[model samples]
Target: MAQPTTSILCTDLGFEWPDGRPVLSGFHLAVGPGRTGLVGLNGAGKSTLLRLIAGELTPASGAVRIAGELAYLPQDLTVASDQRVDETLGIRAKREALHAIESGDVDERHFAALGDDWDVEERARATLDRLGLTGLHLDRTTGELSGGQAVLLHLAALLLRRPDVLLLDEPTNNLDAQARARLYDAVAAFPGVLLLVSHDRELLERVDQIADLRDGEVTWYGGNFSAYRAALAAEQESAERLVRNAEADVKRQKRDLVEATQRLAKSAAYGKARSVRRNDPKALADKLQGKGEETAGRLRGMHTERLNEAKERLAVAEEAVRDDAEIRIDLPRTAVPAGRSVLQLERVRLAYGGVVDLELRGPERVALIGRNGSGKTTLLRTVAGELAPAEGMITTPVPMRYLPQRLDVLDDEATVFRNVKAYAPAATDNDVRARLARFLFRGARADQQAGTLSGGERFRATLAALLLADPPPQLLLLDEPTNNLDLASVRQLTQALAGYRGTLVVASHDYPFLREIGITRWLEWDGGELHAVDPR
Candidate 1:
């Protein structure tokens, strides 16, 4: 039974390029009224499929139909460099109002809807505040917002639209845990069809169902991403077992055929001996001849059929396996020597725009975990020597490097190789160039402008440069290093950090990632006095 006021459906869906090459082929999906996480590798056309479903782009083949308005939130939600947060929110409100007026029943001389005329301006301001975009001048142009703020503003606008479907690509990316939690709450409460693409394991684990795009089509599993992963692992194991069995069957058949052929040969010899002397072997000779011929035929027929079966079985078994595009990362390292003091903070205090008491410190990788407005960034700034600890004594080594939550240290105009040379001036082009390759920025990509790189690529580029530094910064500070990174890159970084002999301080929400890097020391900030606790 199908219950549907409005549901999306696709059958034998497909799309291809102008050259008759397929981007998606024979795709099929049935999206009900729930959140579905789109899981696939980088180039799996997940975003393209979302666009097709939203009617933002038409499929070249087959059908993509939705009955109501849809909202699309792309991964790269950067506004034009000059758009102000308030102005953008206003535009969104006005658009929604116009859409409502156009579609509402009162368009042709009918009474207007009973609701009050929505305040686009006030509501726009309210929307920004709700998304932590308060205090920014509405009239200020878009160019002024920080990269993270810009992303947040776009998200606020998208949410205000209240469309019937949401196609979000990496919505939680680059946001801290609090922001991510807020995003999750919004998605959970949203009463519409949602299809989003993300590599965040935690984010995907909460979706209603998972839609896996593999081999040119979508496969729907009626559970969260974790369940789907478990099922996939089981399937992979089963496929391997089937392959082994099929191989063994072929070997057994070969042995049986050899035995049969030897029996036939022996029977032929007996027949010849009986026939040659004509020594009272009359019926025996005739019987042996007839039996040998029959046996030979049977053996030939059985061997042929068995061989064919084995080949077919092997093919079927092989097709069940998936390609090995597993995520991988390798962090470049120039090690740091251990010292008695990695970092020191005393009776620290912090506040946003005058708020203050967020003391922090660590001689090792220290984690700062708390809700938003809890001063995580404030604490990081204080440690980075960027902010003056208003009420406490903070001491840090003069030569430590800070990788801010946002990559503010790198120049967007410079290529990765150049960036490294600037940070590590003593290094040669060849040395820096080779270092970039280990981080996946090879050759011309190493020469690509930083401004043109993706969020993940930028993270890699910044970290690569840090590694090339002359002293490699005996102390390291990372703010959400895993955010926006694909799983492979994360693994690479994890492996690199596992062996590094440096002091680390991190402000992140990823508990697992924190645990992996060996956070031997931790400080929890509660209304601003650092409480020491063993993170082990």
Candidate 2:
């Protein structure tokens, strides 16, 4: 293999939000050719850095240098309903110019538009096919495609541009298994500088290198996600060991300081008694006493300084160890008896034509798995009473709550505390704050407006509102809950779900996340039918 060429560079970059919240400062990065995975905790400025590199946001200082053309694919991709497939691929104009010139129209503008790109259509089709989009037509409207298809289409557009540097933020967020596989193949084969920010472990595993961003700094790890994890584990173990040693040193320093004080006290007393028993001159005895006191004071000061130094070292050692917090709470009100049926779907036909006959008894946890257009979301909404079934009877005897993928349950203008309070009107203010603290929104964080929160913070606030409802939901419905969450936030969510004793029906494409949440049952939605399956 040959050495890769540098394509993207950042020097002394700085950025801050309008609210005076600093995100990145003096950040420097040099990205070369090959796929690089960017991983970080939520609110760690991963997206912000990408936007800076893509020229989507202006840095407060320094500069971003790109050796060639750059293209960026964001997490939330939105195309107009009327946009045609060819238009989205950026070949509509070129195709029209090529046709006109072939038909003997001598126009300079047409020649200029078609310049050296006569095979644009063929390349577009090939790219589409490569991404498993062979069924889509050039003139098909974007509105006809599924959410996962839209994401793939956006990536196809970026590929069509053939930029030297490519930036992708959560590219596999809404994709199903097949689409995700197609995307992975594309990333593996791309011949340019690729920097992607993602929490998808599978996707991260495909990268050539890993960049772990935290505290406004980037640490490079050789090889893929697994390699990064191994390296990080080793680093953390070393840090923990250093912390332990530093703590022991501090304790020893304190003990030495106390022993020095005791020795000095004994020496001073012995000298004073000897001087008094020997009947020395009063002036001489006073001088001797003064000299002993000064010596003891100097010794005490030296010992105290050593102890302080040891404590500072301990503090620095502790700072090197990462301590990501987990969500832990009790939900006694949501518990259900083992034999009680919380939900029943009797030969039900959803509005989208999916058929299901199921019973959720006790506090069973169900994982709904399927492709993007396979009616998983439709079925979840129908079960949550957000959508009515076309046929059959569905019953939910207990209180339920639905957390949609969009997370639109809370008012954006209101504070997080206010949103939780609205959901549980009967709960006291102290009680609501106490509950929000468990979700990692304490103090002024709970007072921040919902619109101002980061993606993970917003999800936490929405979850807090749902879980803190007045009557307490016994059947919690979550749709693609891990879509935009970072790895830390995903772990936190898994921890939170583990404590919930209510029935859970989570529709997600994240297999690791689903498994981590301790799913008791698995159901696959395919061709409008629900079938039980073993956990993957």
Candidate 3:
């Protein structure tokens, strides 16, 4: 199929915060129909660029043009109540425009504008039902749904609009495998344009083009993430070589300039000596003029250093992304006893009004997984000694610290320094500062307000404190630990977990993260039972 004309075009686009910090500048891009995936690091102004394309914000410079009717779905959408699923779908008006059919009256110009195919309500209902919502859902309040359910509800509205272009940001977030498959189908079924932003490797594989945003510029690659990765690897190698060449050029230029400077100095001294000996005013002045021009010409060649400066600036620009260039982990170590079991629960039954058997041991890194309200978190808390099993005996290893799903462990009002201090009060001012520095929170960063930290930063600060304290915990229990972490920090934390020598148990929904850190086993949570299962 042929691609459509660019639906959105940004030429010389630039944006900066009100405080004069640059977010994106010289960002030029054009996106058309079919699938275009926007890839960027966390702070690369991706959302800002999306907002520009959506016309939600004006660019500081350059032009942004959008064509045709457009529909956009942000990462999270507010679900308005009092509207049923049927009321939200466009399929019901198969023979007429949804607005006209639903209103029972339409202006002639508007009707003509809509053209044919108005009575498509059956088609609309099928789309809704396919998404696991029913015809009765049209009358149900959308607010009374789970996160994934709410996402599906908004998607139905988007499909019904039959938009000329569609924009989705993190569309797969909070979705299960089944829901994600349905979303993929919806994207495939879209008849017009599709632009999406996602970190999902599997999702990006299906896109026709990928655009990576970095250093206030957009670099378009011809293929998916895998191709982009390959291309990036090649580009980094080239950049490194360029830097080496630039350094060599700079050094050579500096040497030549120093030599010329010395020659000019010697010439001036020689001329002085000759002028004193010749005693001829006219000849001495002539010699001075000739030497002056020669020295100036030599200095002019020194512009090579200026060119070298430009290359230096470019090198810094190229290396700005170096930190994101690789994936690495640094797992921390905590001692583990040779004892039979670090933690175990017998006949462990838990629920609002019930009981079930559960048991786990040391040397096992288990992932407790279930859909929402399945009580995966509750079971973790039970083992943490926070919540007791209603009708069973439970065993737990001491010195265990739990990182809750929400960062309740952090003190919001305190400075990051103060917060870290709270965890390890014994550390002196210098010792605490040194520990904070190890986690990349040195100097001013350690002094940053805890409330001001991003979700990822808060997790990092908490983890760093927990691990670097006076004595590390022997048992580690974490709940959805990777939820808000950026890819880089997530890799770092995963690396740390891999090296830790302790009884580990983690309850997470991040499959990739779990695999990276080497989860030893698994526990399936259903009803009120925590059953051990194979990791595979």
Candidate 4:
């Protein structure tokens, strides 16, 4: 595809929180027209860069330059319940003016308000329809729509603007499979400068290239998500090889230094014996000794310099290698025996009107798949005892724990250790600390307050607390667990879950994640009932 005329440029950009914590410092980026997937670990400043470009935030230093108009759809989109759909789309005045003109109002202001957007309503509806939001009334309030529908509606409004540059942050976070497909189409069709910040791999695959933001710097890659992964793997392999070579060089240098020292010691000893045998004058012997000492000093200095240089190279090579740690956990206590009655629900009416009649035995990993607002969460909540079922009986033979999407299970004021300790009250503090280390929270990190930890850290802490509960829950329930997680964190979550041998029920739209965690059974919740589905 040909490039658009638009561009985004950031020159020596700098930003810091009011508390003096710096995020970006002297950052520079220039992106011409192309779909660039911006990705990094959580809190790597992807969203910050987008917000800076969108002018929603003021950088402490430098400037953001754009060739043309820009539109931004932030991750946390909020709409008042009473806000009209037309008003949200930024066409209420124009729509009213068009109506007034059609009704024989000769007011000059009406024509000015309508301006050149004569078919604004048609265009708005078309945009909505393209995003799978057809039949939505412009006069309706935003509160009437589901969360996913509201997100699509906001995106439709942005599309209607037809700006030269578009910024999207976690656009697919709340979208279902169907809605996400529509979004992917819209994104692919956008003929402008597009910068996307998302953890959704499927969405990232649609981008023309990737701009990996790390440590307040951007590294450009020349293809989509899959290509980026391939290139990154190659780079990492080369980096690891370099590190190995550098380490070998350092060891060789050290060995050479040792051998040289040994040779010098031997040479000095022979010279001393010769001096003694020759019966040379004291001054001559002293002069010989001084020369030997000088030579030895020079040789040692040269070897030391080479060793330092080798060590420096090794440090640089090591820096090029990424160190994303994996979570390693063992929860034998959580394992459920075969033929064990994990959970049973008989004609259970969900809060949202869905009926579930199911019995899970043993350590079955069940994936509850469905569209947004399809009562998956309601069913999970009901199973967790967070919500009362409208009707029917529910039973669980083993202890259970639920990790909600919001991750509001911990007390903000308490430390991570305290939180886990709260769950495992009978366990010793040392024991809890040891287990927390397996979750990548070691020593003092376990003492960090839950409120102060980053998104990924908080998640790990929450998972540790749940899995390490006093009774060691034999049945685990998770609702939208992958929803705001970065890719690395998601992998870590998967790793942690791999060790869990209990019955698992997860409600999520992340298919790849569901597969990675080894979901044994697929159940689709639709039309107020659950139905078995093939994985294919």
Candidate 5:
């Protein structure tokens, strides 16, 4: 099939935060029909660029040209508490006008309001059903829906508009497996200029191409996420080889410069000695020595210039090599013995009325998987002793810690340092700083208020506090750990988990991440029952 024409263009785009932090400057982008996944590290301005294109925020300088109507779904979606389904879908006005005309009003204004959209209600309901919101009443309020449902409702609204250009920013951040599958279908069926900014790997894999936004620039990679990753890995390997070759050249140049200097010194000394042996006059001898010195100096300058040029080349080559840091820490104290029972739940009925019976021994990594509102979070909280089971007994033999999905463990008013200090009162300031550095909060960042940090930064701070808490939690319970995290942050979380030697019970919808941490068992919660399952 022939490719669709370009519908969105950005030329010489420039934007900065109110505090003068530069985001995009002299940036340019052109997006045609088909899906394009926008990916980058946290705080790389992907969301800001999308907002600029959506006209939610004006660019400091530049032009955004669009050929057709556009729709945008932001990362954080909010609807009025009393907003009706039809109103959210933007068809309430037409529906109301149609109803008024059907009642024998026969007003030309009603016809004008209806325009050519006589079946607007039918289309709206069809769009909602397609997005897994089946049986939802048009007059139903948004306050009655779950977070995942609300996100789907927002997508349904955009689909109902039939926009020629659609921009989705982290659309699947709060979606469950079923909801995500529905979204994937919607995206696959879209016939428009689609630009998606998301960290969901599965969603990215479905895109026609990947647009990587980095360092205030955009670079397009052909094909999906896997292809993009393959291309990036090849580029990094080549860059690393170039750096090595450049380093070798710099070393060789430095060695040659040293050898040349020694040769010049020997030649100068030999020339002076010959002049002395000739019994030359003192003034003539001095003049000869001065000429020899000047010649040596010029020769040295040539070699020095070559060495400096080689160093500059090396610097450029090094710059091309990416410095993607990984989280590395050793927590031997958090390790559990091989035969020790870490946790036991005896027919435990949670506050949500879900029954779980399980015992974890040693340092097993357990993956908890379920749909939204399936009691996964409730189970984790109960296991962490944050909530008492409604019935039966629960026992944890070691220190336990829970990292909730909202990441509210830290006090917003306190600095990251103080928060961690509060958790580990016996730990010294230097020790706390050292641990925080492992979580990528180094120096002044450790002193920043928890409330002031970005989402990814705040997550790292909370993780640092949990891992560095007093007694060192041996049983770690993480609830939806990868939600709202950027790709780099997700990788960092995986790397941190790799270094953890304690028992882990992580409730998440991220399969790739669970596999990365070497989950030993998979448990699925369905209809208030927890049962083991094969993750594959």
Candidate 6:
């Protein structure tokens, strides 16, 4: 295959965890201009590779070669609450320098700092406006901004830098639909080498190509996520066909060996019988019998060799096949019968100013969607009884569980088994183990500390604990469930929820995920109220 000219290159890159577990080894990648979506399973080193490229981590071996200036937007964007919006935008000093020079202070340092960037504030404002942050004032502190707003502000800062290469690792994780759309636009507008590591299907759709990281190597695929899926499907089909043909060949070889052995035995016996019948001399007949035995042994060895070669070919063919396992489980105990009233809120005034008057009934999968800071998370929290409404009565008749985005349900120090056991104290250890196995945490996997788990594993552990609680949670509230999750994890979560026979309220920006899980109703939080929207 012909390769693109290298703009960002990682040659023989290698990294290992502190505990000595190797991640990338002798890995090589070369990407040119245009957005490249780096995708893989949770532990496939997507984030690690991004970090390496951004120079946040030193590779244990090999080198990262970049053609120009680079900027990185990490998954967790941290900004101090006291930081001014201008600081977050990376123009605070320039603004100060310009102001000082305009105020008649003839400081050479101010002139040097300003450095002909007189329109710094204007550019900052323009960038912020482009990212849908027009209302954000440069003087305002980051504390006044919502999480999604902060992420956009950080991106705006990166834009102000005007880098030649951009690396975004799960940049849309904390963003809402509106925010994500704005980010998508910014990503599309970026005229540079772009490397994005994300599971956001929509964000990935904006990419020029996909770099699939697996088993410490990258396989490039042209086009977006859907195209990549189509290619992967085709590849899998071919691999499966090869495996089937190889299996048939092995079977034919085995049959041939068996038939050849049988024929050899029959011939040998016939030869012995004929020698006895036409024996001129006993010694001559014995010599003839020995010769026949020698020929039979050689024939057997040849057949055995053929069978072994066929088996090796089968193994090689099987190695090309992928094992993408799905999570499967039954939640019979969580079933809420039709017409069962799960929750009710009467003129509920949230602490953040929203008035929610809502009622939920049996097995209704509700999608709670809105712009960031529009109170989706707050509403979910209120329903889960984590927060008391300022005014009004909130009632949930059945037991409920809330899975927050942080996945704080599990104790970081505890094992997955122990975490689930904590939620279901009455259940025996064997019962917990059996249930954990369904979440793909079997045997030693269940014994690992929750803190050490990847994003997908952590989510599964949290979900398992919540669903396996003492009363089996007749109502489940999930806040941003798909945020930062890999595509496979999202699929697993969707499958798990498919079996959930209770009232479900999922606050997420992931529309595709909402659609996949069969959301029966759509509720949008706007103007300080929850309004029902057409399911379409």
lDDT of 4 by residue, 348-401 (tens): 987668788999998999999888766677788899999999899999989999
Kindly list the per-residue Cα lDDT of model 3 for residues 1-536, writing each as its tens digit: 97457488889988875545577677788887788888776557766677778887788999888777888887536656766555555333333455764687766754664566454556566777777656434545654454566677778778777788888877765565566777887776777778888766777887888888877787899887799889888888877877777677667667766777778778777776777787768766787868776776767566556657856865774574365532232434466754536776777776443355544455567777665445666777777777867777876655677887666788878878898898888889898888777676778879877765655677778877777655667678888776545466677677667656677787765788877877777777764666777656
The better-scoring model by lDDT among 3 and 5 is 5
Ranking by lDDT: 2, 4, 6, 5, 3, 1
User: Which regions of candidate 4 fall more than 4 Å away from where they truly are?
Assistant: 1-5, 17-21, 55-58, 79-84, 96-113, 141-147, 408-434, 442-458
Which run of 10 residues does model 6 get worst, by summed lDDT?
1-10
Cα lDDT computed for each candidate against the true fold: 0.70, 0.90, 0.70, 0.90, 0.87, 0.88
lDDT for position 334 in model 4: 96
- Write the residue-wise lDDT of candidate 1 on 308-399 in tens digits: 78878988998887653322334334344444565666555553433333322333677776554456666677777797766666676535
535 in model 2: Cα distance from truth in Å?
3.2
> Which prediction has the highest TM-score against the true structure?
2
Window of ten residues with lowest summed lDDT in model 2: 1-10
Candidate 1 Cα errors over 4 Å, as ranges: 1-30, 51-66, 79-82, 91-116, 121-152, 200-206, 226-237, 254-308, 318-333, 340-363, 368-478, 485-493, 499-505, 523-536
Q: What is the lDDT of candidate 2?
A: 0.90
| Stronger candidate by lDDT (3 vs 4) | 4
lDDT (Cα) of model 3: 0.70
| Consecutive 10-residue window with the lowest summed lDDT within model 3 | 324-333
- Kindly report which residue stretches of model 2 are placed more than 4 angstroms away from their true locations once superposed: 1-6, 96-112
Tell me the TM-score of each prediction against the true structure: 0.64, 0.94, 0.70, 0.89, 0.86, 0.92
RMSD (CA, Å), candidate 5 to true, equals: 3.7
Whose TM-score is higher: candidate 4's or candidate 6's? 6
State residue 393's C-alpha deviation in candidate 6, in Å: 2.3
| Residue-level error in angstroms, candidate 1, position 448 | 12
Better of 1 and 2 by TM-score: 2
User: Backbone collision count in every prediction?
Assistant: 17, 0, 30, 0, 0, 0
